[model samples]
Target chain A: MMKRSAIAFSAITATMATAGVVQATTLEDVKAKGFVQCGVSQGLPGFSNFDDKGNWTGVDVDVCRAVAAAVFGDATKVKYTPLSAKERFTALQSGEIDVLSRNTTWTQTRDTALGLNFTGVNYYDGQGFMVRKDLGVKSALELSGAAVCTNTGTTTELNLADYFRANSMDYKVVAFEKADEVVAAYDAGRCDVYTTDQSGLYAQRIKLKEPDAHMVLPEVISKEPLGPVTRHGDDEWFDIVKWTLNCMLNSEEMGVTSANVGDMAGSDNPGIKRLLGSEGDAGKNLGLDPGWCEAIVTQVGNYGESFAANLGPETPLKIERGLNALWTQGGIQYAPPIR
Target chain B: MSTNHDISTAPAKPPIWNDPVYRGIFFQVLVLGAVVLFGLYIFNNTAENLERQGIASGFGFMNTTAGFGIITHLVEYTEESSYGRAFLVGLLNTLLVSAVGVVLATLIGLLVGIARLSKNLLVSGIATVYIEVIRNIPLLLQIFFWYFAVLRSVPAPKNSIALLDTFFLNNRGLYSPAPMPQPGFMWIVIALIVAIVGIIIMRNWAHKRQERTGQPFHTFYVSLAILIGLPALAAIITGLPLAWEYPVLKGFNFQGGLVMIPEFVALLLALSIYTGAFIAEIVRAGILSVSHGQTEAASALGLRNNITLRLVVLPQALRVIIPPLTSQYLNLVKNSSLAAAIAYPELVSIFAGTVLNQTGQAVEVILITMGVYLTISLTISLFMNWYNKKMALVER
Candidate 1:
């Protein structure tokens, strides 16, 4: 009976989808709804996870808040939908969420093929392996013929295979759907190695029964530019999301912390003036308020602050800002100039 | 003259709306129109949503490279294969597991069902407890229990338990020697086919002899010898031409063998065992539905106990069993999608779960997956319907 109905439903949907023009403007939707629908991960420490009081907090979560601030001048005016890895893309594509800020890796296939535009990198990550220190495996090169555990719906598995195959190493994979399952299997010694993004390795390592017993190998296999994603065609909404993160980065580069954003707004810095809407029409051109960047910087602080708050050395994950640091600070995290 | 006019006008046809046949046709047309309108509305909404989001709506993505590896595929597959190929691999894997599970579950179910009706009190009681215990627990939990609790506790690959220096068991999986077929394997297959044909001929001849002379022949023993003895004789004549690729520990894990991943083992075990319990109850009911008089009548015809069962009860009982049994087969096939939970690389896990995530073509991927399952289910039902018709009692 269920199957019969499902078939009938699909047939109807198929007919209805023919040549119909559905023009989706996420900016308009968010404005009309009074809140941005943000798609987030089910839970990933320091990326998108709940706090002690059940409030969502993470670098990825903060990206959505920044977008919300840019759009509505209110950082808290956003509702999060926790999505599994498999459901995130569809949720975004189907317009179920205005923006997907779920630590999704920006890839060529996703950006072009899946009709998604990655706004900007919130976290610079790479595929890395984690193994027990007692295994006498100091490097990833020693992991030939190892049974590796990883999450199924992730690029980590593909990267693992690529890295191994390129090096002509034979290995076995034991993949799970959920991150916690992979961690559990790794913990239970079901596999010799656990592989994922380096940040995820640090995050999940803390969940292990004995955190110090495992060591992350010193090899970065693939570049993972984790960022928020939006629908491809809405250039206006795309600019809003993209510039929201850029505002944070540009603020950090200009040394304008959240506490001193107001003071710096009055400064003689022409770049700051333009970014804060004191001088130009950059924000207005993107269909947002003139003070859009100001709201982002004032409410969510700069990118460094968001990073420090969620994933800095003080946090449980204790991930350092390596490639995530500004280009001037010997890192590749550079945003285009506001002027 | 007024009564004649009323009759000539067909009682004014009661108006078309008041006519029963017209009303029925009108209602059906209304319902059909409403359904089509509703369908158009949803499709238009989805199309607008896709167009608005700039998501491409089509099956063109199937041609793109999959760029991933499947752990165990029956067919040759590579990371460089197209999404279409990957989908085929997933489909085949799903069918393979379902087919194997169906056969195993039927065997176990039949045995348990027979045991449940045994004269021995302990045997029947144990069978009842087994049925009740397994039937009540959810299959997903059973899969989890086997995967997480039982399988995960096994020793790691470094300390794999070696059985007879041929098989290796570890947390990763059970690894045994894989048979490498030699050139003579074809002849052995041919020999088995010939033996089957020979058995059929033998059975026909025995039946005719019995009818003519009122004498019985042990067709079962003769058939069994032909089947087993022919294969053995072929293997001997062919010098037993086969090599074994035994699993050997190299560095961190075993290599060079047929490795059955623990996830698949757990999923198959869970699906088969769980479905088997329900099947057992169905079998018991089916057997009981065959009246006691049938058995008594067969015995009165001087047929022995085994012959009575094989010739009388089973064929009749099958007709009562088939409809529900068809549903169970469908249930098992659908349940095999639970392989996703265990990451066994079946249709749901690979093509639907991972490929959907990678491609982000949810509608297309889901449609294809649904179509595959629907096709499988419809085919099974059609086959079972034919079998049921054939097995039904023939009446003059």
Candidate 2:
């Protein structure tokens, strides 16, 4: 009896050990699973917030949709796992998500040491401060000795500390783990100023009790290039996510909206035809179908369309596409050519 | 008859499998070997998986600069401090809240427990209601109530509620005067230590004298006088080697002084009150476990009411109270991890939450945090066991 049980125990241990040793095949895994698992923020307006009807609509959400469209030719073939700032990276690194489309800042250490790859910059943001209008604070430098509130486990907290120390000013930080708690703490006057990405400042402002009473300061402290991320060591899957974002940017620069992508597929311009998969093997090189770029543009829309629908002047956040505009329009959002 | 005796005396050996003792030993060895193999498998699997995922592993990340600010730190820390220092800061904050919570819980528990047995109906009723109400609610909700509902409603820094023109209370925190020690402050501290030592010796002498002469000396008042007098004399001789720095209103908030952030207050209040309710129940059970005969015997001996309760009944009741009370203390220490939910900068909040996120080294950070909590819990258990041994009944 003892010998038999021992043999069984060894078998169980061997199987358990081998279970975790499977090689990284995220693209194949996603294909077999029939949907791409995307990680996003818990709730950041104009970035990754869900509506009352349980439908998520945001600029970051569109990235995941584009990847899903490129992979499955179906934009809705995606599942989102809402994560906090602390849980986002671990979720992607552990294979819990195929891609992390959260508004995560791209930093050197994260790209090199964290075993993750940043696909491309989706938004160019900078750390900014927001204060009550009655505080009479015009610039971030003027707000010395202020109690600052921000979310923990993010670049915002580090940026706030660096900005104060460099300016020879003393400050108190009241950081919370969740964005909602930070908003509540700031609204309760627990802090004198709320600091985060300028876009985040605008996004979180709407959550305040009196959104109009708060104003974002003019100074930008740190460069925050926000983008989507995927696990490293999987070049095939990485290329798919990277080129999916590139497809959106390239399509926008070519003036191909979701409304006009079908007609542009047959255009005489070789650049447009190759981008739409009618003239070159761009899609095959990434191990995707021939019409992957076309699928992304038609189903999820280009970068400009997603930005306009989710975060443009017509939306509640009313964010202008200044740094996010195409390079031809004098912004820095230039993508590599499709050819 | 001799042949029958010789035949019976010859013993027969059983097979190894049929021998109960050998079977037990064999099975035990098998189980131990299996457990060892399982543990080895898990360790190897984790190492392989971490390597396969390309996520860095090890404690080297602790040497890197933390580059962040913590709100409540007991020791000197800065943005340039190492992550190891950040861990220490977080550990100290956790220790502070847990230590204060344990003391306050014991005091409140003792008071409420005795009150529940009081003859006065109102006092017992109130105590009973307090235990039922506080212990039944979830601790996290209580924390939220204290933080958001109670402290958040306080006035802001601009209109801080001033006390004695030195201490202030506002939504940000409670600011008070901080003592800045000068060169001769060491002499005053030495004086205080000497006074404490003197009090301990006097108490020992007083206990012996009372036993021999059957007359008690007033040791409490004498000890109190020495404790204060020695410190005061040293301060006068040293020309007062301490200066008080009061908090003053500056640009946006209070400038200098000691401050207790609201997060600490809310967490401490919630932990103390919640644990107090459980301790109160344990105390009541302990007191009731002592038979009624002991109380009646004390009364028959003509002891006063308060004296009989304190000297006779309490010593017996404590034997029953301590073991369970130790468990409550352990629970409070472990529950302090909930401070993460409210951003109290405790070990789990700042170290495991923020540091783990920043470095992406979840395995190492979580292991270190768990190890710290284990060490703290074991220390508390060791101390409590020693205390329990002292209070145990000694039979003649």
Candidate 3:
């Protein structure tokens, strides 16, 4: 009887010990799972969306695939989970999705309170309104009691209320649960106006049946610095996600692209040598191979290539790099220099 | 002969494990022990995990200031209030939405359910189509279609179509006058409560009179008049002081009125319509479950169609309907969590997302949310169970 009780007690203790350890090397877990669970926005054009063949491609998807490439040596190792703004943070914290690259704003509350760590800003956006062109409303201030369709459960909704209130203009708000719904309602004439991050407005506008009928207003309301986020407990996983964005930014600054990364990796430039693993074991420090940065650039293209492919002027979304351009090019797309 | 006599007259206390009476007690104790130990293990692990991460495991986060901003709430709040206050606001909103949805769904569901059984083919067919379409589709999809596909299509404020002089319809949501409370409003409120109490007393008296003397009274209509008339009389006697803050057409939007955001509108409409479909089916099944012989007997005894339904069929049907209806109510309370999807500033968004991120207390934040839901579900269950026991058929 005593032996039986002892066995039961030991079993209970063992289970507790195993369960108490919250997070370990998330990289190992992702590798074992064979795919990185990537949280993405719902159908943000150029940021994340499914092609006709059901394959996801976008600026945001590249971030996920880049991380996957750095971890598992394969860029195709990603499982995309589409999330709205409200679902994005919980999904990250609850371990529903490994990394959230859904153009989520890094707010003070989110960074400090939500048990989440924003790795780095992937996109810098601002709250802006988009309206049908035939309305002849050139500026945000031109409209007084404008009925606007905005996303609910987001900072955008609050910002809209504040902007209209601060301006002392009376306006009505039509709030929707999803960005797609807001855009759809705007298209269907359910809402007189729609507001979101400027880039999102551009992407949504392109998806409209009457694309030319809408124009994005020039007034940028709130500062929205969007980035990838991870749960806070796992430092190793945090570093991996953080460095992936850094790699993209560093690669872009170093002029590395899918086409030219091979040549640069072999180049005699000290900066290139250090970054491409030609000089030292910087890759080992990150628990990756020396060619980790090289693989990311050659396989996924640098940040500039991704931006141009997804939302650049030549693309269907037709967004210009006014604020998104590289630091050297007068935009805010600058990163701390690679050591 | 001796061995046979010994077998027949042996002691009634069987072998140790073979005693069925002790066996039952042992099984119960074993089951109880397993459950207790399981719970203890989860508690221990959770405590250790919290300690390991240097995270404080408690409801202390509730007292901490919620610097996060919430978009739409039924109450006023600032960025510097305790998180507990925000949680209370969320709970109140959940109850508000659920209560409104339940009342609306019941009215519609009963009408549609009865109409489905109507003699008129056109009316029944319309009701049937509504049931088949709504019940077959998912609740979430219905919410999406309402918010995204249907409500989002409203025109801009400049193009807002006028609904009478006092209202306008645009994508922004229905706009109407904000109720302005006048002086002596408190007296009117008191009069309404007193009138409701009077109706309850009259209903009990009517029930007893009918039982004793087999006499009928128009209790419902009388109660309605008293409840409504008393309030109306008080408002008038107090100088009819309430005024309307009418919505005025402004340059780009409506001004000076209560605005219902489109998210709330869509969610309320979708939840009601979808849940109403199920409630209708339940009502239909319940009414059908009552034997047709009872209806035949009531009609054969010279009862009117409405009288037979109200007197005989409804009481039985309610017994069947009440249990399932209560479950649906609980489901609605839980499903309001979906409001987080559209940014409605409910518990999940504010407490789970904002609070969890701000504090880095994953287990605590999620557990609190889970606990809140569990409490809501369990409270509803307990109340409904008591009601069920009261209504359950008793064997003679």
State which candidate has the highest lDDT: 2
Compared with the true structure, model 1 gives a TM-score of: 0.90
Q: B152-238, model 3: which lDDT tens digit per residue?
A: 467666677777877887765678889998877898899989998999999999999999999999998999899899999998889
**Native interface contacts retained, candidate 3:** 0.31
Candidate 1's DockQ:
0.53
Q: Chain A TM-scores, one per candidate? A: 0.93, 0.94, 0.93
Q: Candidates' lDDT values, in order? A: 0.89, 0.92, 0.80
Clashing pairs in 2: none
Docking class of 2: medium
- TM-score each candidate: 0.90, 0.94, 0.82
Q: In each prediction, how many residue pairs overlap at the backbone (N, C-alpha, C within less than 3 A)?
A: 3, 0, 24
**Residue A151 lDDT, candidate 1, scale 0-100:** 83
- Candidate 1 lDDT, B201-255, residue by residue in tens: 9999999999999899999898999999998999999998888999988999888
- Per-residue CA lDDT of candidate 1, range A36-76, in tens? 99999888999999878989999999999999999999999
Candidate 2 residue-wise lDDT, A100-132, digit = tens: 999999998789778999999999999999999
